[model samples]
Target: MSTALVLIMTPGLAFFYGGMVNKKNVISTMLQSIVCMVIITVLWGIFGFSLAFGESFHGFIGNPATYFMMKGMLGNATWKAAPTIPLLLFAMYQLKFAIITPALITGAFAERIRFNSYIIFLVLFSIFIFSPLAHCTWHPDGILAKLGVLDFAGGTVVHMSAGWAALASALYLKRRNEANHSPARITYVMIGTGLLWFGWFGFNAGSAFGANALAVTALATSTTASAAGGITWIFFDMLRGRKPSAMGTCIGAVVGLVAITPAAGFVTVPHSLAIGIISAVVSNLVVEWRTRTTIDDTLDVFPCHGVGGMVGMLLTGVFANQHVNAGNTTGNGLFFGETHLFLVQLLAMVGVSVFAFFGSLLLLKITDMISPLRVSAEDEELGLDISQHGEKL
Candidate 1:
């Protein structure tokens, strides 16, 4: 059930992003998301899962051979971290995450990127960026795990990585020919928000790997943070003299979800509320700042996901309580007078931001060389739906 919940988020993302682009590009934008479900699944079943969760190769990545073609996943096999669930179930659940991470970046390059080039980048990112980060963050013997870093869900592995990649993509692709278009459908955005919010319960809580007090706490925190984020975003807008809008509310709610993800199982509900409020405000400000710049991140992915993920990670170091979950073997957060955990979180955040940002820029360059990353000017005016897919909305 949790796996299915997470899977729905990709289509939710499709509507969320598809609704925000020019009508001419709506189908193209949505298809960019839907394609990941098909592409990443085949990759995961082959060697993608192994590269993320198999025996670690010196704390960087898992050995691809460990689970090649799902070889050893049988009746009794189980992941050590999720011993109660079959290894196959664990692998499938993790695959949902891999599917969404690349899909999230589609918002940044929505109207402009070539479908084939985008496919190349998605495969590269899953194998090179997503796999190593997942292994280091979640695997028992991986580097960040050894360093006592905590990510209850995937602030670093999913949101932060996608956020940085979005930034890199915006820079690499430059800008759309017609960049000032209104959203194709605000109703679609509202519906997508509902689905994303609903699925996030599984995204955060299911990380606990079983029905337990920890999953309960994660679920509770995720709820409060998301609510706080939504209200705070609209209120913040009003404070700045802008009207409270549906778009602001939805974006805020999602930002809250992203911020709470890494801290859901580690912090109390009150702290989760604080995390949501802080993350929404920070992301909102960054979005405003981004618009003043020449960089064209079509959907503000970096400001919302990247900054929100970073805020959540840093605050986890500040508000995390070992009492919340015994997994906090590292120590209490800075709010509890301990400094070590906060320092560790800060170090990990810096390292991940650098790697994800720089590595993605390199991948974009390579993809561009293999095939043109953008469509021709004629296609730009005609719309990607008709030009690329031979279909229209």
Candidate 2:
């Protein structure tokens, strides 16, 4: 059920992003996200999962041989992370995580990238970038895990990495050519938002690995944070002299979900509320600020996910209560009378931001080499649905 719920998020994301782009590009934009379910799934089964969850290789990556072709995962085999479920089930669950991370990057370069080049990037990023980061942060013996970075559910690994990669992609791809641009369909965006919100409960709570109290708390915090975030973003819209909009409210709710992910298991309901509202306000400001800049982060993925992940990580260090989850090997946060965790979270965010940004930039270059990264100007004007796929509504 958890895996099924999370799988829905990628398609949800496709619609969310599809509706935000020009009508001519809608099909291509949605396909970019849906395609990850295909490419990343194959990659994960062969080696991506092993590189992330197999035997640790010096705290940076997994040994491909440890679970080659997912051997030893049948029958009574079990993983330490979730001893209650079969190892195979756990692998599928994590595969959903792997699938969505790259899909998120599509939003940054939706209309302009060559479809073939993006497919190549999907493979490369899963193997080289997302796998290693997942290893470092989630593996029990991984370096950052040993340093006590508290990512209950991939705040750093998923959202932060994707956010940084989105920024790198925007910088590399440059601006789109559209002179008069507006979303093609806000109704699609609203429906997509609802699907994303419904799936997120599983995304956060399912990270608990069992039907336990931690899962319950994660589910609770996720809901509270999203509500607070939506309200806060609308308030910001009003303060900025614009009417509160459905689109803005939807984006705010998703931002809250992103911000609460890393800390959901460690913080209380109230802390989640604070984290949501604070992140919404900040992301709203960043989106507004982006309009004056040259960096065309088409969907504002960096400001929302990247910044939200950073905020959640830092606040987790601030509001973490060992009483919520006694499993925290690291001491409590600054609010809990320990400054070490806060500093550690900051350092982890810096390291991840640098690695993801530079790594994605490099991958984009390599992908460009493999197949021209951007479409020709003629193709761009024709729209990707027509030019790339030979189809259009």
Best by lDDT: 1
Candidates in order, TM-scores: namely 0.99, 0.99
Q: Candidate 1: deviation at residue 174, Å?
A: 0.4
- Estimate, for each residue in 1-393, the C-alpha lDDT of model 2 and write its tens digit: 888989999999998999998999999999999999998998889888999998998999999988888888899888886788999999999999999999998888888999999999989888888999999998998999999999988899999999999999999999888734899899989989999999998899999988999999999999999999999999999997999999999999999999999999999999999999998998888888888899888888999898988888988989888899988878788987999889989999999999999999999999988899989888889999999999886
Candidate 1: Cα lDDT at 350: 97
Candidate 2 lDDT score at position 225: 93
In model 1, which runs have C-alpha deviations exceeding 4 angstroms? none
Best by TM-score: 1
Q: Where does candidate 2 clash, by residue pair?
A: none
Q: How many backbone clashes does candidate 1 have?
A: 0
The pairs that clash in candidate 1 are none
Error of 1 at 323 (Å): 0.4
TM-score of model 1 relative to the true fold? Answer: 0.99
- Per-residue error for 79 in candidate 1, Å, reads 0.4
